[model samples]
Target: MSSTRLLVIQPSRTNPPAALAEWLRDAGAELDVVLASEQPLPASLDGYAGVVCLGGEMSALDDLRHPWLASVRKLLAEAVTRNVPTLAICLGAQLLAAATGGVVRPMEDGPEVGGRLVAKRDSVGTDPLFADLPWTPDVLQFHSDEISSLPAGAQLLASSPRCQNQAFLVGTCAYGVQFHIETTTETVLEWAAADPEAAERAPRGGFTRDGLDQLHEDLAETWKPFAQRFVRLAEEGPRPNGSLGRNLPLV
Candidate 1:
C-alpha cells in the first residue's frame, strides 16, 4: 500500500539505522522515526505497519542507565505477539532475545567488530527474510554481548564461528540479527572514532574507513534486497483481526 508506515526506534544517538531506512523508503514504505533515547515509546504497536529497532553502544541489560530500554523491549515483545513484522539489529537483536526468553551476555571472547561473514543455516531456506542469501554473507559486527541462547521455538537462520545466534526468526514475522546490515562507511568511521580501543580489536582485522566503504558496498549488494523484502512483508500488514496471526508463541 502506498500509505504504509513503519516505526523506526533509534535507541542511541550515534547508532541510527541509516541505510536500512533508505532502502525501506526506496521500497515504498514511509517511516516514522522515534528517538527512544529522548522520547517515550507509544504504549503499543497499534498504528505502525512494522517496527525496526536499531543498534547502540549499551548492553541490552543496562536498563538502569537507559530506562527507556525496558519499554522498548516490551514493545518488541508486543510486536512479536501481535505478529507485527520486525527487524532487530545488534543491541536491538539482544533486546529481542531477552524480551522473548532468550539469553544475552558478554561474549567470552569479547566484542565482534568490523566486517565478517556468517554462514547461513539450512533453516534459512524457509525463512522469508534470509532464504535467498549467499552461503556466507558479509555483515558488520560491533557488539560485545552475544546471544548465547535463543527463545524457545526460535528458528536459527545463520551463524558465525564466534556467535551461534547470528540470525533467527521468532514467531512468524519477528527477525533478529546479531550483525548489522545497515552500516555505512561513515557510520563505521564514526563508531570507530568514538571507540578507538575497540576499533583496534576488530575481529575481521582492524578496519580502515576505505575498507569499510568497500565492505558496505558488498553489504548493500545483498542486504538491500533483503530490506525490500521486509518492506513487502510490512505491506502485507497484520491479519484481519489485527493480530500478527496464530503462528508461534512469542515468549
Candidate 2:
C-alpha cells in the first residue's frame, strides 16, 4: 500500500491532459507513462500500482482497424485478473468494457458534451475509490461512444443523466469514470478548438474556454477529494472478488 507505482496508458498522439501529470504528482504516485504512438500494446503491468487509461480518437470496437486496441484489451484483462486498480477514461473505458465481458458501441443515448451535471449512483455513497462529498458534480467531456454495458459482476457507481454507465466498478475495486474529471481549462480549449462547430454545438457546457476555466476553479475542491481517494485505492489495491470471471468473459 505504501509504494504502489502508477502506470499511465496514453493512447493519444497528443500529450495527455495536463491534469494527469499534476494529479499523479499530487497523489505521490511513482509515475510511468507511455503513449500509443511511441510504444506497442500490452506493455508490462508488473509492479504497476494502478493502470490509468487515457482517451484517444480510436474506437474500441475496431480491433481490426487499430490492432493496438487488441493489445490493450488483453492488457486490461490481465491487469484485472491481478486485482489492479484500473481507471479508464473515455476510450479507455470503452476498451475496459470490451476487455471484460461487455460491449462497446456507438452510444445511442446521444453525445454528452461540456460541463454536465452527474449524480452519484447509490453505489457511490461508500465506494472505496470514490468517497461522498457532493450530491452531484459537473465534469468535462469528449467522446462519441461509451461502454454500452458493464462487465459481469460489476457495480454501477455514477451517472450523468445522459449516460447510464458513466461510472462502474469492475472487481479488484478497479473503477472507471466516463466523464473527464481529469481535464483542465487549457486542455478543454485545446480539444474544443479541434472542431469549429463544437464551441456552441456541444450538448453540454464544456465548449467555451472561459466557461471551462471558471468551472475548473469551482470544481477543484470537489474532484480533488475523489482523485485523492482514488490514489489510496490504487496504493492499497482493490477489494477482493474484483476480477471478472473467465467463463462469462469479454468477447
Candidate 3:
C-alpha cells in the first residue's frame, strides 16, 4: 500500500534467494515475502512499494495445475497498470510476458540450463538498474520455455545467443528476466532434485556442482549490485530519467 515494504512472491520452494535477501536488506528495503505456492495473493498492490516474483517449476500457462497462477498474473498486470516497481524472474518473467501480449513457448534449441552469459543491449547503458552491468554478465539458466517475444513497447535489456529475450523492461518499472540472478549452488541442487530430467537434457558444460559454485561466485559479484539498485529504486520512489513513475504510461 503506502509503505517501503516490497512484496517478494516465491512461486516455488526451490527458487528462494540464497544471497539476495541479505543484499536487499542491506540496501535499505524491507521485504514482505509471500509463498504463493501455498497462499493466495493479496487483494491489491496497495501496501507494497514493489513486487518481486520468483521462478517456479510450472509453466506460466499452467493455470489448470496451479490455479493461483491466474491471480498472480492479474496482480502482475495490476503492478504494470499502477506503475508499481516489479521484478519477475524466470517463470515469473514468462508470466509477465504472457500477461502483456508476449509469447512463451518451449525453446527451439532446448533448455538453456546452468551458467550462461547474456550481453547487454545498447539501451542498457542508460537504464537505471542495468546501466552498470558488464557487457556480458554471468547468469544461471534454468528454464525450458523461453520468452519468444516481448510485450508491446518493452525495452530489450539483455540477450544471449540462445535466448533472444533474456531480459526486458515492460512499462516503466516492471522488469522481467529470463535468466536466474538470485540463485546459489544449493538452489540449483534443489531445483535439479525437483526436476531430474533436466540433468539429462543439460548442455555439456552444465549440471556440475563445482561448476555451479564457480558460476555462483561470478553471479554474486555481478547481480548483487543490480539487486541493490532495485532496492534503492523501491526506497527512493520514481526517478527523473523515466526508470520509474506512476504517471509515466507505457509507450
Give the number of the best model, judged by lDDT: 1
lDDT of 3 by residue, 62-112 (tens): 888988887788888778767778889999999888877788899887778
lDDT, model 1: 0.86
Number of the predicted model whose TM-score against the real structure is largest: 1
List ranges where model 1 is wrong by over 4 Å.
203-205, 239-251
Q: Give, for candidate 1, the lowest lDDT window spanning 10 residues.
A: 241-250
As for candidate 1, its clashing pairs are 82-244, 83-244
lDDT of 1 by residue, 85-128 (tens): 99999999999989888899899987788788999999877666
N/CA/C clash count, model 2: 6
lDDT winner between candidates 2 and 3? 3
- Would you give me the overall lDDT of model 2? 0.73
Backbone clashes for every candidate come to: 2, 6, 3
- The better-scoring model by lDDT among 1 and 3 is 1
Candidate 2 lDDT over 40-87, as tens digits, reads 654568777788888887788676777677777777776777777888
What TM-score goes with each of the models? 0.93, 0.89, 0.90
